[model samples]
Target: MANPAVMVLGATGRIGRLLQLCPPQGLHLRLQARRAQAGNSTGDWHIFDPRAEPAALARAAEGAAVLLCLAGPVPGRGGADADMADHVRLGEAAVRAGASAGARVLLASSAAVYGARGGLLAEDAALRPASAYGAAKAQMEARAAALGAELGVPVCSLRIGNIAGLDAALGGWRPGFTLDRFAGGRTPRRSYIGARTLAEVLAALLAAPVLPPVLNLAQPGAVEMGALLQAAGRPFAVRAAPAAAIPEVALDAARLQALLPAPLAAADPVQMAAEWALLEPEMAER
Candidate 1:
C-alpha cells in the first residue's frame, strides 16, 4: 500500500511553518499556498489561489486521503465582510474538493466561537462569537459541517485553543499586547497547547480512520497571562477591563484525549515560555 497523500492549505502561516519544520513521518505532504516563494518550493508544493482558480484547488486535493483546510484571513487585518467572505469561499472550496476525491476534510476552527464565556466549554457549546473573527470562524464551521453532510464526506472541525509559539509566551512583552487582565485585576485563564504538541495531534488526527464531527483541541489545564509573563522573565503591567469582558475560552478536551494513545499532557505555560526564550536566539540565527 502507498503512503496516504495529505493536502494542507495555507501552508505558509505560523502553524504551517511549524508543520513544515517538524513534518510528520509516513505521509506524502502536498503543501499548498496562494503564491510560490523563493525557499518554500522544495517539496510537493502547489500554488493555487482559491479565489482565482477553483479548478486548481480541486486538482491539488485529488488523490489525497486527507485535506486539511488551514487557510483563513487573520483577525484585525481586514474588514469583517472581507475576512468572512475569504473563509466562506475557502470552506466551500475545500468541501467540494474533498467530496469529489472522497478525502476526509479537517477544518481548523477557533475556540473564539464560544465568545467570552467562561467555565468549561464543550464541543456542543452554543456559539456566541464576540468578535468579527469569531463570527467568521463560526460561520466557516457551520458551512463545512453542512456541506460535509450534504456531500457525504467525512469532515471534522477542530476548535483549537491558544497555541503557545516561540514569540507567544517566551518573547519580550509589551504592555497591552502581553498582559491581558480581567476585572478585579485577575488574570484570565485560557486553555493552551504547545506548538509541537499541536502538530503531533494534527498528524494523529490525519491518520485516524474514524473521527468525531467536532472536537476541542486543547491542553488539560489552563494558564494565566500573569504566570506566562513571569515565566518569560518579562515585567508587564495589566489594565483592568470589565468583568467577563476579556474573552477567556477554556476547552474540555476529554474527547481528544481519549483518541490519543497516551495522555495529552497539559501545557506548562512557564516551561514553554522558558524553552522558547532559549530557542529564540538559535532560531533567529538560522
Candidate 2:
C-alpha cells in the first residue's frame, strides 16, 4: 500500500522550511505555497492562495489523509483583523476540500491566543488574549471550530507554542538584543517545541484514528529565554520587565502526551538551541 499523503499548506514559511529539511518518514508529502520557491520543481507543489482559489485547494487536498493549513499573515505583513479573516476563509476551504474523504484538517494556531495568562494553560482554558494578534487568533479558533462542526469534518486547531528555530529568543538572536528581566529576577519563559519535533507530532496526529477538536502542541515544560540565549552562546543585555510583560506562557501538554507513542523532546535550553542550530545553514540559503 502507498504511504498516507499529507498536504502542507504554506510550505515555505519558517516552520515549513524546517519541515522541508527533515520531513517525516513514511508519509508522502505534498506542498502548497502562494508562490514558487527557487529550487523546487516537485510536481507535488501547488501554487495558489487557498482563501481565493477553492478549486486549487480542493485539487491539492484530493487523496490526502490530512490537510495541514499553515497559511496565515505573519506579523507586520498584514493587520491582525486580516489574519483572523483570512484564517476563517482558509479553514472553510480546507474543510470543504476534506468533506469527501473526511481528511483531517489541522489549522495552525498560536500560543499568542493565550495572551498574558501566565500559568500552565490547558486546551480548555478560557482565552484571555492580551494583544491584537492574540485576539485575532482567539476569534479565528472559534470561527474555525464552528465551521468544522457545520460541515461535519474533523478539524483540529493546534494552539502551538513557540517553535525553537522560529522564536525570538533563538532565531532572532543577535548582538545587543534586549531581554526583559522580571521583578523576580527571571526572564520570560514559554513552552517551546523544536521544528523537527513539531513535524513528527503532526505526522503522528495524521496517522491516529481519533483526535480532539483542539490541542496544545509543545514540549512538556517551559524553558527560560535567558537559558536559551546562554545555551546558544549568545551575549545579550537585559532590561527591567515592563509592567505589561508576561512572566510565562507555559502550556499543559498532558493531553498531547497521551496521544503520542513516545515522549516529546526535553524542554532543556541546550537541546532546544541545538534544534535551532541544525537548520541555520539551510534556512540561510532559502
Best by TM-score: 2
Clashes of each: 0, 0
Candidate 2 residue spans exceeding 4 A from truth: 77-84
lDDT per residue (tens digit) for residues 181-286 in model 1: 6766667677888767777888898888889999999889888867777776677776666554664668998999999878798769776676465545534443
Task: Indicate which candidate wins on lDDT.
Answer: 2
Per-prediction TM-score to the true structure, in the order listed: 0.90, 0.94
Q: Write the per-residue lDDT of candidate 2 for residues 50-79, one digit (tens) a residue.
A: 888888888888899888888777775565
State each model's CA lDDT, in order: 0.79, 0.82
Model 1 scores what on Cα lDDT? 0.79
On the 0 to 100 scale, the lDDT of residue 185 in model 2 is 79
| Candidate 2, residue 102: lDDT | 66
